[model samples]
Target chain A: MELKGRAHKFGNDVNTDYIISGRHKFKTLDMNELAKYVMEDLDPDFYSKITSGDFIVAGSNFGCGSSREQAPQAIKCAGIGAVLAKSFARIFYRNAINIGLPVVECDTDAISAGDELAVDLSKGIIKNLTQGREIAVKPLPEVMITILNDGGLPAHFRKHGTFNL
Target chain B: MGKTIAEKILSRHSGTETYANEIAVAGLDFVMGQDGTSPLAIRAFNDMGGEKVFDSSKIAMVIDHSAPSPLEGVSALHKLMREFAADKGIKLYDIGCGVCHQLMPEQGHVVSGDLVIGADSHTCSYGAINVFSTGVGSTDLAAGMISGKLWFKVPETFKFQINGKLGRGVYSKDLILYLIGDVTADGATYMAAEYVGEAIDNLSVEARFTISNMAIEMGAKAGLMRADAKTEAWLKAHSDRVSQPVEADPDAVYAKVKEYDASRIGPQVARPHTVDNVSPIEEVEGTLIQQAMLGTCTNGRLEDLIIAAEIVRGKKISPDVRFIVAPSSRQVYLEAMNRGVIQALVEAGAAVVTPGCGPCVGTHNGVPSDGENVISTANRNFKGRMGNNRAFVYLGSPATVAASALNGKITDPRRYVR
Candidate 1:
């Protein structure tokens, strides 16, 4: 899948609470509405500008903190094609993959928004569509690849009844 | 040719002696969850063409978030889950039982060596009693609802050996907070921790639970210790099943070993926004506190209350502070009441609530207003987790939280020591 957009970069440990203050959960009824305020609390202009297919590239430990499922749901629902961080919090990583959100972990570099990038899961490469630059990331392992391609664990199971161990 | 207790449990429920840190696939034995993810997962389940669960007995749900629902959807989610469970013949618990993991063991649903998967990250809490537990995604949970199985990765084990008794004012929460400081946030990624020490054997199940519950903060697959007499006693009172224990063999191999001296420990707190940003309770003194909550699956046990009650027995909470104590279970609640500890707490101006993982999940009842500062006995105090983005949450022991409640600021427990 190709995602063409500016890359918005963040440092390591960009936690779930920073994306959406858990306190504001009271104000919003559903996750769809909540996605509008994603990352708005940390950066006020984040909600208005963030568009579809924009990759969120981070340094390390992206999506740290409470196991709030909304953290990933909001990000994926907002149409992020892939989240390529140096690393991910355990819960956030699982939550993203389970929700069918494309999340990859790659080496840290100077990839920023407006550098339109195309993510090739097959070739394990992230091509900067705008800058015409390309960076390679490790391909997803076979099992995880199955989960991602199948559109999350639930969908995968639905398509293929329990994979015999 | 060989296996540890965790390896044996994982293998039994997963791939046959498979790849390192990887599992092939297998059926699920138990699925557990709290209020945070169940509602939305059920919604997703319906949206995803998921009809019925594979089996009702294989699933268990609890309302630990928002014991009183600090907000609407979360509360409605709990109510919806209750109705759904009742409608589907699924076993469900409200604030009536306590936190998911607490009630899990209390209700005899999660036995030692059982493979339990939960929607909440802290589902690893079951590992303290030797269960091979892991946290799963909500959608995966929905799929597991209909299909009674899930996959897992074999986890490397990190063994923490403890020696010496804790010094005055230090407790298990402090020990975990200290470990976070030493190891950093991503220290134990994909690693299960097994505690082995004289101190570990001597501690109560509740204290051990506190340790295991926070394993995620260290990026661990799960934290655990061999079940001992303390676990047996706790199970006898809570579980109706014939008791069994899961312990590590004397020759079990571990990935890494870390050691700590308990006597050198002091009460510590995880500063806002990160569990690893730990500092001594004395260092953060005068950190203006607006709320002090003393309870959760992490620190809401009876011993935690006893420590809080002793601190607040005669002193009154500051008028400026909102102090809430939430026990983790009905049994803990009843136990606290029968011991006259409840009277001391109530007299000290603390509002007591039911047993569950309330407030800590950022649910209402103790949500701090904007610009407020919170000192809590719960886990995780990331920005905006309380009520407002401006609100600050500082994690501490019951002793620190209790003292902070009395003074309305982040005061160390040392000053309150008699």
Candidate 2:
């Protein structure tokens, strides 16, 4: 699958609380509503600044605190296409994929904010359209690719059996 | 090849030899979801077409995140959980039952070598008692609930061995904070950490729980220790489930081995915004604080309460400070009351609340205002953890929090100990 988007830049250790503060958690469990607050703490104007089909490039250890599924769900529902980080916390990485949110680990320092980029999951290539450069990323495992292709775990489980694993 | 503790446990559960990075389906001894995550898990379960729960007896749900139902929305979520629990016959821990991690082990739902999974990240708390416990998201938890099994990518093991006794005013909280500071937050990502040493062996069960509970902050899948006579005694007293304890082979392969001299460690704290952003108490001392919180699954045990009470028994907290104490579990609350720990804290001007998470998740109770600073015993000082994004949170030992509460500023715990 290929994803193209503008880049939103975040620094190291952008935690869950920063992604969507817990205060906004129970206001509604709806992902779209929660998406309106993604990165609200870090950027109060995040909602107004973000556009659909945009991607985020972050330094190391993005999504570093809490196992809140809302963190990734909010990001995905916020219209961000995928998140490219130097690294992601384990639970966050898993939750993003489970919810069909694409998160790739690659060197993001070279990618600046607002760069238009295209990511190819199967081939592990990211094209910087704005900069005319190509960056390589480690392709996800075949099984993970299958999950992403099916649009997250629920869809994967529906298409396949829940017990297929 | 010799197996690590995680490998040994997973292999036995799966009835197949498992190694690092190998994906396998592991049968669970217990499956859990708290109010914060259960709603999501329930939704996923429905989407995955789950019928009756795979094992009602093995499933557990707790309502501690928004206990007392701070708002109508949370109350409705609680109602939904209650209905689901009643329909499925799953065990439900209602409000005031304490945090899920503390309640699970205290209620005897966990046993050595058992494979447990919870929707909350701190589920690794069970690893303190030598269980193979890890955190999963709602979808993974739903699949486990429906099938009584979940997928795992076996993690490599990091062995931490420490020697010598800790210094005065230092506790397991300090030890863990110091270790995490050294390893950094992502040092153990996707790995299993096994604690072994004279120091760990000498710690009480509650102290062990404190260390393992924060394992998630270090990015470990599970923090493990060898189950010994102490473990056996605790389990026998608390649990009716009988299972032989599992142990790692002496020659087990490990990703790395780290050795430490516990005697050299000092009081520590994880400063605001990042747990890995740690510094010695002396280095960050004298920083002002408006609130001092002492509770949560991490440090709200009876032992922690005792330390807080000891420090503040005769002194009044600074008039400008707000000190709050919430026990980790109902049993702890009852025991603290029976032991007069609660009264002593109250006499020192502490506001003792119900036994639950209590503002640790920024959900309810004692939320800081914008620009306020806090010293807390609970784990995680990430931005907005205490309800306000602009606030600063300093993570410290119960001793440090208690001392700082009295001073109205960050103070080294050692001064009050004597």
Top of the candidates by TM-score:
2
Top-lDDT structure, candidate number: 2
Error of 2 at B168 (Å): 1.6
Candidate 1 lDDT for residue B303:
92
Score each candidate by Cα lDDT. 0.78, 0.89
lDDT of 1 by residue, B114-206 (tens): 777888888888878877777776776776787777666677788888888887778889998998889888888768888789877778887
Q: What TM-score does model 2 achieve against the real structure? A: 0.98
Q: What is the C-alpha RMSD of each candidate to the true structure, in Å?
A: 2.3, 1.2
lDDT of 2 by residue, A1-165 (tens): 789889999998788878988888755578898888889888988877878888989998888777888889899888998999998888888889888888998989779998999998778899999999998796676667777888788887777766564
CAPRI verdict on model 1?
A: medium
- Quote the true-contact fraction of every model: 0.50, 0.54
Error of 2 at A82 (Å): 0.8
| Chain A TM-score, cand. 1 | 0.89
Candidate 1 clash pair list: A6-A113, A6-A114, A7-A113, A7-A114, B28-B149, B70-B364, B327-B355
* Top-DockQ structure, candidate number: 2
